[model samples]
Target: MPIKTTKKVTNKKVVKEETKPAVEAKKEEVKTAEVKKATKPAVEIKKEEVKPAETKKAPAKKATTKKAAKPAVEAKKEEVKPAEVKKAPAKKATTKKAAKPAVEAKKEEVKPAEKKKATAKKTTKKATTKTTTTKKVTTKKMTKEEQYAKLSLDTCLDLAKAMSMNVTRDSIIQQLILNPDVKSVSKDLVNKYQLTGKFNFEEDGYDEGLVEVLVSKVYETADIKPQKAEDLQADVDHALNYKFTDVVADGEEYKAQFDTMRKVLMIAQHKDIHDSKNLDEEIGIDVEKFVEEFMDLAYSVLKTWKYEDVDYYEHFIYAVLSQLEDLHDTYRNRIMMDVADLYILHGDYGLGDADYGYILRENQIKDYIYYRYASIYEGVDKDKAKQIANQALQFVDDRFTYYPNIIAVLEG
Candidate 1:
């Protein structure tokens, strides 16, 4: 019985050993399954943390997109401002173009008014020029009296037709008689009327009106007694019949004395006194005596006529001196020098005196008179002498050849 129990114990031990290994393997498997469950929970925690980080990243991306969109909007607004600026310039350009046409139209409207003003001014200027031209033309014409005044004394005498049978009641003759330049014409007419009785109304059938006018003019110009027109014919007849005795009581005697004086002058002319050095010895006639007598005769004639018959005295002196014109210059000059010397010595006579008019009518006598006066004034007033000497040279005649010598003496 003991042997059989040993065998059973051995079998039981073997089976226990096998069953212990199996239980260990089963324990390890259970440990592994629990660890796996714990690891799965950790992995799940990490996944949650990762998911939070992804959400923060997503919000950062959205903020960046919004910032980018704001910049785009600002860029679009800036572009719109530039477009509006370009439209403003275009509007200004259109306005300026429209204003230019308006200004041009205003200029066109003013042009015609300016042209009308210019035309009116031109027409007024032309009208003023025409008026001035007409005034100038009117002022150019002279009158008849002015024309006659310009004529010479000889021309006036010729126009009068004096001392001719064709002489009529001419207004020109009356004008000439009244003209102071031809005052001697009155004396000539009177002498002719007295000599030829040409003015006798009934005898010569002369115009009574003309005779009366002639008588009136002669007496009036001589400053003599003015006779009536009715008595002119009787006075003229009486003058003719009595040899001008009605005018002067000693008319014939005065005439004879003039004739004698003329003969003496003729004798002096024939002697050629210019060539004679000793005038007193060569020509028996005394020049000083002759000049004195001639002056005395002139004074006597003037005194007899109450100094009112200047024309008669002038005529007588002219008649006497006219004969000496043909004489040599030397003799004539010597005679005139003597006369000037005598005049200066007298001291009462001036060159302006009417009595000296006939003497001065001869150019040589005038020059000598000036020379004498200048020479006399040279000692007292040198300036006055030079002035007088210079005046002598102003005469336009051939007799003033010695004037330069006188001037040289004055200058010296």
Candidate 2:
């Protein structure tokens, strides 16, 4: 009975030992509950924080699944659509069917173009093979004026200007031909411009219409010479002024204007005296009497005739005066002296001023006029002649100062 009781006790102790740990666990749970009760607000706050974390992870997991599915869905859909198939392929097909005629028309159009391309390629191949036909060479011939009209004067002159040869119009024309700008045409135009008898070398000699076109580009675009600038400028001026117009006008105003200038110029000059008139006789030379008589005719013309009606008064005036001053004959002197006397008598010193303008135009004229005047007065007024001859020196060009005529006049 005692051993059974002891065995029962041992079994109870083993069972009790396990039960005691369980009891301690129950006690820990009770204490943990009390502790949790004391920290319940903190536990609730941490649970709230963990809830947002869990919520964020929930959406992330859901989003990852949807992202994977979306790609799979889009890829599967794309596999059926192709690039342009989803775009109204029926309308596109109809448009393509409608464009068939245009395509056929384009193909028809391209046929001739392809033929031309093939022909051009064949020509190119032929050209490369060192076989030039005579027909190709002969097709490009041109006339002289036609060829000349094509080239700028600079292009024509480039060859001559390169060689530093004479660059005259004639010289340029001659050289440009040798460059063989299409051979014969260049040669003929050059010969025509340079070798013609009818072509004038002076300003008025140029074609008035041609002058208008060439003058603006004389130096820059054309091959004209520096010495020819003045000549060309004069031509353009003449073309712009008197020469372009017809000389016919009311009452022969043109002729009258030109004639009157010459008449007045002749009337203004001092007369040359003869040997008999030089001596102290009744017929003795009196330049004052000569001046008085000539001034009468000059005044008559100034009152009766016109001087300003001419188109080229400037040109005419100078030319007239130049002619009168060149007069060395006694008859010319007598006629001109009578005209001079008339001008002073009429109180129209305008003609004298015009004469002075002509003298002042060129140094040559100024010197010549003075020399002529002093020659007439040499015996009558030696002191005055010496003064007049000295005055002539001032009018002579610097280069011509030591000229033989100047030295002889100085000594005389």
Candidate 3:
């Protein structure tokens, strides 16, 4: 029994030892719980501090997002603006390039037009210079004496002016009385003055109105050498013998008839001058075919009549002029000069109702007409002579070969 009890005590000791170890394990767990409670407060404090910073950062993040969005919108607008600007500059550059070629083309076109204008101006200047030079040459050609040998009333008037003499009616009468034939007297005068060929004295002894009388007077006064006489005579004879084939105011047929009548009248006048008896019956002029020729012959003869023969020929002159009044006469102006001489010099102004002043006023007076008018007015009316001369200035042509004669009468 004692042994059994001791064994039980030892068993209890074993149980106690095990139980004490369990109690110690429970104490350690409680201590761990307390330590966790203390750490919880610290952890809560840290979380509280971190929460405030996180709250502030949330608003900052929102503001940063809004700023980013605004910048993106502005960048989009900037991209669009840059695209438009680049396109506009490109279009402008293209237009400038196109316009440069057009401007260059216009400049090229203007260059040719400017050259043409310059050439035209040069041509006009040359033309004017050439015209002036031609005129100067013509004037210089006229002064030579050899050029004077081509004498004609209408062709070489300049030469006539140089050779013409201003003689009186008394001088002509005296010259005629000295020799019955004025041609023979002219021949003597031409020989005496050593001017046989220069003075054209017709061998036929035909009197050509005032021309014959004037030639004789000029022969006496001219200081020409005998050697030049033949040239002057040939020129004058050629001019007189030149046929009137050119159409005048009348047609060629009328001119032919006029030439024939002039020849007949010239023959009749020659016969009357040499022989006192009228040759109208002998020349068959009073016949029906020659009646018109007869009247023309009588009229031409009256023009060359002496001052003493005016009374004898007054009736005949009236009859011839009255017959001419109805016809469309080419010699109407020439006939008027004879009428004027009769009225002014003689006592016959019997031209019925014809205006002498109106005839004179007609501007149809040419260079040849001026010569006849001036000769009529020379001794009788000096004022009329001067007035008629001054009026003829514009009628003078520069191109005429006989321009000098007309100038001499007007400007003398």
- The per-model lDDT (C-alpha) reads 0.42, 0.36, 0.40
Judging by lDDT against the true structure, name the best candidate: 1
Per-residue lDDT of model 2, residues 1-412, tens digit only: 7955553433332222121222233454434333222322233233323343343343212112222222211222222223323332222222233222222322332344445567667878988764556665665576544444555655545533333333455433322212212234334433545433433324322222232122222334433222222223333232223321222332243343333333233223222222222311322223233322333323333433444322123333333333334322333333343333234234444564344445445334455455554554454555655665676677665565344444455577
User: TM-score of model 2 relative to the true fold?
Assistant: 0.18
Off by over 4 Å in 1: 1-209, 212-311, 323-370, 375-386, 389-412
Task: Judging by TM-score, tell me the better candidate of 1 and 2.
Answer: 1
Higher-scoring candidate on lDDT, 1 or 2: 1
Mind sharing the TM-score for model 3? 0.24
Scored by TM-score, the top model is 3
Clashes of 2: 12
Residue 342, model 3: Cα distance from true site in angstroms: 3.3
Model 2 lDDT vs. the true structure? 0.36
Runs of candidate 3 exceeding 4 Å displacement:
1-315, 321-328, 347-356, 361-365, 381-383, 394-396, 399-403
Rank order (by lDDT, best first): 1, 3, 2
